[model samples]
Target: MSASVGGAVYAALAYLAWGLFPLYFKQIAQVPALEVILHRTLWSMVFVMAVLLVLRRWAWLGEVLRQPRLLARFGLSALLLSCNWLVYVWAVQQGQVLDASLGYFINPLVNVALGYLVLKERPRRLQWLAVGLAAVGVLWLALQTGHIPWVALVLALSFGFYGLMRKMASLGALEGLALETLLLAPLAAVALGLMSWQGRGALAQGEPGTIAWLLFAGPLTAIPLLLFAAGARRIQMTTLGLLQYISPSLQFMLGVWLYHEPMSGSRLAGFAFIWAALAVYSLDGLWQSRLRG
Candidate 1:
């Protein structure tokens, strides 16, 4: 197969896996989200370390270790990643998967706004209009729901900042993730130890099957990421931008259909506005890409 086709397949598969993550997390729904996050961090570190070891990618680590500023920056990125994970998992476990999905749906626009505000990359007027529509959608959702959609907002913002940091990162995706997890491992270890000492640990109180699923989280987390990185390397930006909606779209369907989350007309209308914004933003991007070409 051609490179772009292969890349599209890889990217779609990655997004498909990510879209179905609610199923995976639901299997361990009995476990506390924080505990799940801890296990995820520990095992992700383990998994990535093994991958690096196999690839003999230790040189980067030594260079990274010498740079205190890099370490500090990654430390902050690690915090944002963990926060994103915690909020997302918590939302899923709490039956707020729709909110979680909406967060991701909003994430692209978040990236654009962040680019404009933080990176000083000027977005076109259409991009600004897209952001405005999303804001209005969010506001309408708040009015209808009687509260802010904090879960969606937190997930979007945390992940947007994390993506920003990664854009500035010196390492590749696997190595960056490895470093982020390395920074997080100690906290995970300490927290798990405390939980074990308090007799509240998953090993102590959870089922064997549940513990097994937790262990599987490592591969599950890393595989899609690897696929995405591989796909991204071979694909055009416009293709990647358009394909990015797959995960959230799947999540939204699963939320409303499988999980039976309430989808009121007002809620649907808010989502309509968001979708319209994305349509405008994506079409504009496509036009720009064509013009540049």
Candidate 2:
């Protein structure tokens, strides 16, 4: 029980940090979202490499790289993660942070669906109901905006699928992330180089504050990842599922309450549907957990 509680604490802290990510990114509004992503990818690579060196994980890294099959899986994960990062940054910058929250709120349901479809896993009836409710929420958002929130959907799908791939790869968090970041670094460098050549690099013309804020991206991206690795091993997936809501919930509050984003009837209905779905999902998780015990 104590371990579980600690896991929850770790998860909560990670999610809270993630929830506040928009405000941090907002500080560098002068930077293009892709440029920000490039910095994140590049610096994350540097940070992870340093950690690996400190721990002397080069043997493990070399072993993993020698296994071309594993490298291929990690490469796919890197691509998907990159897409998720880029989309999220773009959404936050475009004043659609609330919609991004909605995407995450619906993510667990999507994960469940993927489990059934891709992994051939079976979900109980209540779980199916939860997925249906979440579907309704997506529909409501579509009705509200008179267009599908593709940015949100893409973000959710890419990230969710990335998680699935990571699971399949069966790599430890640090080792796996190090490789993923390494794979992405060259692309990020190219992009950053182009931005510099175009005279639009954030570090070039942005304020000292922006430079400092940009540097925070490396630690911000890495800390939660480290926490997630520790917490995931100690907690049940169901518990993790519940905890995943924290980030989006905080994002939603920041959007509606802090940023004063619009809260129209359609969006309200969408959020309502999502909450209902989560409640059902939570109940089902508890029931299943009890049954397993």
Estimate every model's Cα lDDT from 0 to 1.
0.84, 0.81
Least accurate stretch of 10 residues (summed lDDT) in model 2? 232-241
TM-score quality measure for candidate 1 = 0.89
Screening candidate 2 with a backbone cut-off below 3 angstroms (N, C-alpha, C), the clashing residue pairs are none
| TM-score of every model versus the real structure | 0.89, 0.90
lDDT per residue for candidate 1 within 115-136, as digits (tens), equals 6677676777887787788778
Per-residue lDDT for 89-193 in model 2, tens only? 888888888988987887776677667778676778987888899899889789878888898789778877875675565677788888899988999989888
Candidate 1 lDDT at 97 equals 93
lDDT of 2 at 218: 84
Candidate 2 scores a C-alpha RMSD against the true structure in Å of: 2.3
